[model samples]
Target chain A: AQSVAQPEDQVNVAEGNPLTVKCTYSVSGNPYLFWYVQYPNRGLQFLLKYITGDNLVKGSYGFEAEFNKSQTSFHLKKPSALVSDSALYFCAVRFRPGYSSASKIIFGSGTRLSIRP
Target chain B: EPEVTQTPSHQVTQMGQEVILRCVPISNHLYFYWYRQILGQKVEFLVSFYNNEISEKSEIFDDQFSVERPDGSNFTLKIRSTKLEDSAMYFCASTPPGHSTNNEQFFGPGTRLTVL
Candidate 1:
C-alpha cells in the first residue's frame, strides 16, 4: 500500500524566516507526491506536486518543494515565512496501480505550521 | 475561476440514521472523489467516481456507504446507517481529464458530520 509520512506534528517559525515542512513517502513504483494546505474551517488547497522532471517543483504562494528519489522525500519550503502562511500542511501520495489515473490519494497525518509575526 | 462547492457545512445525525452529503464539482471536471478526516487523523480516501461509476474505493468505504451522481451536476455520498465512529469532516474533490497522473484535484470546503 502507498503511504505518506509527515513526521512533524507542529513546526514553529518566526516571521520572515525560512520554513521547511518535511515529507516522506512509500510506494511500489515511482511516486506522485503532492502538498496541500488547509486553514481553519476550509478545504484542502493544492500547493504543489512532483510527478517527474526537475527535482525542484515550485507551487502557489511562493512555495516550493524538492523531490529526492533516493531519500523518497518531497519537502515543502518557503524562502521567507509570513504570519499568513500559518496553516495545516499535508503531504499526499497518489496510488496509481499500473500508472492509472483512476486512483485514490493517501494523505499524511498533517503538520501544523505556526509562523509568529 | 470555478471551484467545487459542498452543501450543509455541518451536519448532526443520530446513529442508525441515513445522511447524504452533497457536492457540486468544477464544471469541467471529469473525475470526482470523497475523502474524510477524523479530528486528529490523516485525510483518508473513501471512494472515487467517474462516468457515474466507482473507479476505486478504500477498505473504509464498506457496504454502508454509497455514491451517486443522479443528475449532471450534483455528486453525493450517502451513508445508509451512520455510526458513532462516522463522525468526521467529509471533503469532495474533482479533477479534469488529462494524460496520465499529472492532474491535481480541486477540493471543496468540507462538511463536518457528527453522529451522535
Candidate 2:
C-alpha cells in the first residue's frame, strides 16, 4: 500500500524568513507527490506537484518543493514567509502507471504552519 | 478563475435520515471525487466517479453511500443513513481529462454535516 508521512504536526517561522515543511512517502512504484494548503473554513488549495521532471518544482504563492528520490522525500519550501501564509498544509502521494484500484493521492496527516510576524 | 461549487454549506440531520450533498464541478471536467474530513483528522477519500459511473471507491464508501451525476453539471453524494461518525466536512472535487500526471484536484468550499 502507498502512504505519506508528515513528520511535523506544526511548524513555526518568522515572517520574511525562509520556511520548510517536511514530507516523505512510501510506495511500491514511482511516486507522484503534491502539496496543498487549506485556510480555516475554506477548501484546500493546490500548491505544487512533483511528477517526473526536474528536482525543484515551483508552485502557486511563491512556494516550491524539492523531490529527492534517494531520501524518499518531497519537502515544501518558500524563500520568504508571509503572515498570511499561515495555514494547514497537506502532503499527498500517488502511484504512477495509474493506481485506479487504490485511488491515487493518499494524503498525509497534515501540518499546521504558523507564520509569526 | 473557474472553481467547483457545493451547496448547503451546512446540514443538520437526524440519524437514519437520508441526505444528499450537491456540487457543481468546473465545466468540461471529466472526473469527480468525494472526500471527507473529521474534526482533527486526515482527509479520507470516499469515492471517485468518471464517465457517469463509479471508477473507484474506498472501504468507507459502503452500501450506505452512493454518488450520482443527475445532470451534466451537477454531481451529488447521497448517504442512505446518517451515522454519528458521519458528521464532518465533506468536500467535492474535480479534475480534467488526461490529468494522471500529478492529478491536481480542484476542491469546493465543502459542506459541514452534523448528525443529531
Candidate 3:
C-alpha cells in the first residue's frame, strides 16, 4: 500500500514572499509523485510531477518541487507568492515497480495555501 | 488548448434513484477515469477505463457502479442507487497513451451530485 502525508493543514504567505507546501510519502518501491491545485468548487489542476530525472522538477504556474529520496518528501515551492495562488494543493504518490497493473494512486489530505496581499 | 469536458454541472437525485454522469474526454486520449470527492475528504478513484474496457477499479466501485464509453468520445459513469453519502463532486479525467513518465491525467470541471 502507498500513502501520502501533508504535514500542514494550511499555510499562509505574504505576496512576493517564497512559499512552501510540505509533502511526504511511503511507498513499497520507486514513487511517482505529483502536485495538483484546486480552487473552490473546481476540479484539481495538475501542477507538476516527479518521475526519475532531476531531483528538482518544475511545473505549471511558476511552481516547482524537490524530490528528496532520503526524506521521502516532495515539497512544493514557489519563488514568490501571489494572491491568485491561494488554493488547495494536494500531493499524490503512485508506486511504479515492474509495471504492475494493480498499482493505484494515492493522494494526501491536501494543504490549503493562502496568500496575503 | 484542448481539455476534458463534463455535462450537467450539477444534478439532484432522490434516494434509490439511478443517475448517470457524462464526460467527453480529449479527442486523442486513450485512458479515462472517474473520481469522487466527498466534502472535506480526499479524492478517491472510482474506476479507470482503457481500450473500451475497465482496466482497474477500486473497492468503492461495487456492483452499484458501472462505466461505459458508449460512443467514440463520451465516457459515462452510472450509479444504480443514490444515497445521502453519495452526494459529492464527481470528476472525469483522461490521459493520452504511451507516456509512462509522469502519466499526467487531465481532469474536467466536475459535476456536483446532490442526493436528497
Root-mean-square deviation (CA) per prediction = 1.2, 1.5, 1.7
So what's the TM-score on candidate 3? 0.95
- In candidate 1, how many Å is residue A7 off? 0.8
Q: Which sections of candidate 2 miss by over 4 Å?
A: A96-103
**True-structure Cα RMSD, model 3:** 1.7
CAPRI class of candidate 1: medium
lDDT leader: 1
- Top candidate on DockQ is 1
Q: What is the lDDT of residue A14 in candidate 3?
A: 99
Off by over 4 Å in 1: A99-101
Clashes of 1: 0
Least well predicted 10-residue stretch by lDDT in candidate 3 chain B: B95-104
Q: What does candidate 3's lDDT look like per residue over B1-116, in tens digits?
A: 99999989999999999999999999998878899999888889888787878878889999999999998989999999988989999999888766533588889999999999
Q: Give a tens-digit lDDT track for model 3, residues A1-117.
A: 789999999999999999999999998777899999999988889999998989999999999999999999999999999999999999998643353332345789999999999
CAPRI level of candidate 3:
medium
Note the B-chain TM-score for every model: 0.98, 0.97, 0.96
In angstroms, the error of model 2 at B24 is 0.6
Order of the predicted models by TM-score, top scorer first: 1, 2, 3
Candidate 1's DockQ is 0.71
Q: What is the interface RMSD of candidate 1, in Å?
A: 1.6
